[model samples]
Target chain A: MTPQPTAASSPRPVLYSFYRSSCAWRVRLALNLKNIPFDTRPINLLAEQNKTPEYKAIQPFGAVPAFLEANSQGPALVESVAILEYLDETRPELPLLPKDPASRAKVRALVEAIAMDIQPIGSMRILKYIGKDKEAEWTSHFLKEGFSALEKMLEKTAGKYSFGDSVTMADLLLVPQFYNGIRFNIDMSAYPIMSRINSELETIPAFQASHPTKQPDCPPELR
Target chain B: MTPQPTAASSPRPVLYSFYRSSCAWRVRLALNLKNIPFDTRPINLLAEQNKTPEYKAIQPFGAVPAFLEANSQGPALVESVAILEYLDETRPELPLLPKDPASRAKVRALVEAIAMDIQPIGSMRILKYIGKDKEAEWTSHFLKEGFSALEKMLEKTAGKYSFGDSVTMADLLLVPQFYNGIRFNIDMSAYPIMSRINSELETIPAFQASHPTKQPDCPPELR
Candidate 1:
């Protein structure tokens, strides 16, 4: 796909991301999958770098995975799902969404099953704010409940990845959430289809390169 | 836009929705905005209708706002954002997404800021699960935090609605979340831009008709 022309000569897209943020990981995987040439500027969530005014200027929500388009025509896009959609639109070679509207909807529903239904409730900030005592239990319960439904959906959808053989938006969404499930020590044995797809996606270079441990700001111990 | 032909002489799209569910409200508003003919099958979330096997068969997540398309070939869509996108694509007459990719990205970013960042955490299920004691406090904090950023975003994007003069996907997303923020008693005075846009959108017939109180399932006291 030809890069969309911009008014000003644009530099490489810069991704403001945090190493361990699952949301950030989704965009990194998308950039690699689309083979979009880009650079990363790590925002340390632990250090509260994301809350600083400097970072807030890029993303008003102060969230990581803010995508600064090559051309500085508009504000840097926040929301990982939005960034993924933008990349897919601007770089449409390996289409993340299917051609058929219904098929595209199915893929998107699968993505949101994880992104909206599961991830936000289990996010660090939410869990921490709710209380530190039952974080593990809350995370585990929601993950199990979400994965139970996702596993059923994947039973009909998965071939090798979350939706048939190709790597679509669903797969990009799954891997990061799957990582979080592992971090929370959720019982993965119950979700056979998701587990299988996560393993298959792990073999791909795009998925491999975007792993949290491989990111530039990954802590020494984690690396 | 012409409705795509389907086998078995497909019926009008069926929307499984609830009156008070902000997520469902998003899809309801979208269907109205796109002028898609759909029948509502109200699922009483308070009654746990969404948790039954019958509902789960349609949406594995067992969530309100499951959209069963006119055709039966594809699975029912669960996520409101996904359902909105499908409606916009399949019924493209009054385009919900902007023609330009950059403009579309801007609209999508605004949508996700609410759908992903705000709604999930402020959801009834999440608040109930966290504990009833701090529910008000928790909801209030998250809404304030989310709207602060959204207010700033609208400063750059809003004309009459979230992304300019026309009713775009951003507007569809904002109205439902704004409804929730108002329910939580978040001080709306802080978010003047969002408040103004939301009030303007409320005047539109589509938005007015889709309000939770107007839905078939709305209880008399609430209505």
Candidate 2:
């Protein structure tokens, strides 16, 4: 499909992202799948770049994966899921959400299961507050609890991708979170459904390119 | 405006909700605002009713505010934000989201700011992990940080309600999160915009009726 036309005067879409941010990777995956070319401005989370006043002005929460539109209107869409929805709306070539309201709702529920339920639960700030000693346990506890339930929901929904054959918004959320599971040494064997889906997604170019190791800011050894 | 009628054979819409849960209260507010009649099945979180296997079947995440649609599709919409979207799409009488895409994106961003950033930060589960002695301090810190950033975003969006004079999805999220701030004794004076918008929302019937104190499951002391 031919991509949508941009106003010449408009700025190219820019993503303010962190290399290791699952939220940032979600946006990266969606952008790659949609075949929309955008520039990535890396905000280093580990070094606390997001905490700076400038970054906070961009995203009030000082979180990464904030998207600037081709026309760049309103507040920079700060939330990852919201940015996915925005891109899916404006760029409509490869629609991330299903057309049917019921299907869309289900996909969005899966989106939230990862985005809201799982991802936020393991926020670096929240994990740090829990203290360094138990960070591994704390992350594992939330991830396992969230993934087990998500695997059950995926049983009803997964065909090839997270929703059907198509790469809907759910898959965009799933891949980065699965990467998180890897970081925390989650028992992926327990979640056969997620494991199968992740394996299938690993072959996809968008999923592969959006991997944390491939990002511009990823450390050399990690890359 | 009259609400849409469901198919005669299909069951009435049901919302598994717990009163004081901010997440559940969000769906309650949306249902009320949309003027849809849904039977509330109270799953008391404090008593661990949500942890039961039966409730888990309905909501794989074991969270309250799972919505069973009139037609009941593949999966029950388990997240409050997604449930709000479902109700708005299914019953169009009261549009919880704006028609324009940009505005809708902004509204959803506000939704996530509350749903993802603020509400989940204070999950009773997470707070319990943080320990009881510092619970108030922990909740207060996250709430203040989240609300302060959100207040800035509200400046760009708020008119009479969260988005404009008419109530949208953002208000549903705001009212519940604001109630949570009260529980945590968050210093509200810093967020004049949120306080003002919240004050306006308090006068709305939907917002008032969905209060945590009004639900059947709420204990007498809370009511």
Q: Best candidate per TM-score, number?
A: 1
Off by over 4 Å in 2: A1-10, A71-74, B1-11, B71-75
Model 1 pairs in collision: none
Candidate 2, lDDT over the whole model:
0.83
Instruction: Give each model's whole-structure lDDT.
Output: 0.84, 0.83
Error of 1 at A109 (Å): 0.3
Could you tell me how far off, in angstroms, the CA of residue B190 lies in candidate 2 after the best superposition? 2.4
lDDT of 2 by residue, A1-223 (tens): 1122232324678888988998999899989999988888888888999988767766778888777777655346779888888888878998998888888888998999888889998888788777889889888888898999899788778889889888899998888888889888998889988989999999999888989889888899988
What stretches of model 1 exceed 4 Å from their correct place?
A1-10, A71-74, B1-10, B71-74
Chain B TM, per prediction: 0.92, 0.91
Residue-level lDDT tens digits of model 1 in A1-223: 1123232325888888899899999999989988888888889988999888767766778778887788675467778898888889889999998899888888998998898889888887787685888887788788898899888878767788888889999999899899888888887867888888999999999999999899888988989
